[model samples]
Target: MKLYTYFRSSAAYRVRIALNLKGLSYDAIPVHLTRTGGEHRQEGYTAINPAALVPALVDETRVLTQSMAIIEYLDETHPEPALLPGSALDRARIRAIAQAIACDIHPINNLRVLQYLGRELGASEEQKNAWYRHWVELGLQAVEAMLADDARTGAFCHGDTPTLADCCLVPQVFNARRFNCRMEAFPTINRIVDRCEAMEPFRLAAPSNQADAE
Candidate 1:
């Protein structure tokens, strides 16, 4: 297996964590997202993933895209230490939390959107970061409420073990801290993230630990 990844990309980070948790070793093909007009936008990577996104996984003849889809694929293919474990209702709850971060929170603050805010729309750096912080704080507040209210919430998002939700949560929290978003209000989130960061899988998959990290 080969993974085309950008070290700082949160989506890539999530996939890396899942791969680590599954104990699946793959060749890490670094695709620089910001150097020389972005390698992901160039012909070489576009040919592999027409979307030109980082973190495209090639397993033998199969090519997988999208962080969530790739994660679910890994969970399906490698069932041990199930990332989306539990009953149907439980899975739905887990997915809800993951989507709350990936779909709702991440899309608005990802690199492309931030670049568009500056390059295309002519927004200042302060405005772009403000936009990132606003969405992240609002979204995480809801996630905090969700986790705090749920009886199923344990050391991780869904239960004691890390799930798809935790994978999504850790990366988002990393970004939040990077942007200096105030975290004092989200105790559940902080506690869970602390537990995750202490583990080798999460630590090994951190952006700073990636081979291509600058």
Candidate 2:
């Protein structure tokens, strides 16, 4: 197995955490997202993933794109340490939390979107960063409510054991810290992220720990 990844990408970070949690070993192929003109846009990489996204997983038979899909695939194929374990309702809740971060929060603050804000919309660096912080703060506030109001949120996002939601939450929190977003408002999020970072899988998957990190 091999993973095409960018060190700072939160989406790729999600896949890395999931792989580590499953105890799956794979080669990490660093794809520079902003060297020259972005390696992911190059023909070679695009041939592998037409969407030109990071965290594309190539197993023996197929190549998978999208972090959440790849994570579910891993969980399905190697079911021992299930990423989304429990009843159907429990699973749905876990997925909802994960998507709250992965879908609603992440896409708006992604690298390409920020670049578009600066290059196309003529936004200054300050403006672009403000845009990033706004969405993150708003989204995390909602996540804080979701986690704090629910009894299901435990050591991790879903329960005592880390689940799919924890995998998604840790990376988003990392990005929030990177952008200097105010985190004190979300005490529950900070507590959950602290617990996750203490675990080996999350520690090893952190952007700073990756081989491609600057």
Candidate 3:
């Protein structure tokens, strides 16, 4: 397997963690997202993923896009150390936690979105950062609530083992700290992130640990 990745991309970071957690050794095919006006926009990469996103995976005949979809594919292909937990309800709760970050929080603060807000809309640096903090604060508060209410949450998001929810959570928290989002209100989130980042997979998969980190 080969992964086309950008060093600081949280989405790419998530995939990297998943790959490491599953003990899957894959080649890192770096795609500089911001060099020469985004290499991901180039025709060569657009051919791989028309969405122009980082962390596209090439597994033999199949090429996959979207971090969550790629992760699910990884989980399916390598079932040991499952990324999800038992029971349908538990699975749904875990997914809900994941989506709260992936969909509600991540999209608004994604690189492309922030670039558009600043370059086209004339949003100042402070305003841009405020935009990032706003959504993260709201989203993580809800995640804290979810964690507090759930009996399923253990050392990780869903159980003693890291699940898909923890995979999503760790990356988002990484982003939150990068942008310096207010995290004091979400103690559960902070605790989980601290624990997750201690693991070899999560530590090595961090944005700063990536080859192209600047």
Candidate 4:
């Protein structure tokens, strides 16, 4: 497997964590998202992934795009350490938690959106960061409620083992901290992230630990 990734990309970070958790080794093909006016926008990478996104996984001839879809593919292919293991309802809950971050929170605060805000919209750095913090804080607040109120929430998001939700949660939290998003209100999230960071899989997948990390 070859993973075309950007070191600091949270979406890529999520896939990295999923790969590590599944004990699947893959060659990391660094695609610099910002260098030389963004390598992902170049013809070479766009050919690999027409979406011009990072973390496109190539397993044999199959090319997978989108972090969540790639992760579910990994889970299905390597079922031992299942990232979405459970009954139908359980799986649904896990997917919901994952979507809360990936779909709800992350889209609005993605790097591309921030770049557009500043470059095209003439937003100041402070304004852009404030926009990030506002959405992250609000989104995480709902996630906190979801975890705290649920009886099924365990050491990880869904159970004692790390699942798809945990994979999604850790990277979002990492980005949240990078942007100085105050996390004091989300004790459940902080606790879950702390537990995940202590594990080697999550630690190895961190942005700072990646080969192309600056």
How does model 4 fare in lDDT? 0.96
lDDT of 3 by residue, 116-135 (tens): 99999999999999999999
Each candidate's lDDT (Cα)? 0.96, 0.94, 0.90, 0.96
lDDT per residue, candidate 2, 1-214, as tens digits? 9999998999899999999999999999999999988999999999999999998999996999999999999999999698899999999999999999999899999989999999899999999989999999999999999999999888888889988899899999999999999999999999999999999999999999999999
lDDT (Cα) of model 3? 0.90
Q: Model 3: what TM-score?
A: 0.97
TM-score of each: 0.99, 0.99, 0.97, 0.99
List runs of model 1 lying over 4 Å from the truth: none
Using lDDT as the yardstick, the better of models 2 and 4 is 4
Q: Clashing pairs in model 3?
A: none
Off by over 4 Å in 2: none
The residue-by-residue lDDT of candidate 4 on 1-214, one tens digit each, is 9999999999999999999999999999999998999999999999999999888999999999999999999998999798998899999999999999999999999889999999999999999999999999999999999999999999999989999999999999999999999999999999999999999999999999999999
Q: What is the C-alpha RMSD of each candidate to the true structure, in Å?
A: 0.7, 0.7, 0.9, 0.6
Model 1, position 201: C-alpha lDDT score: 93
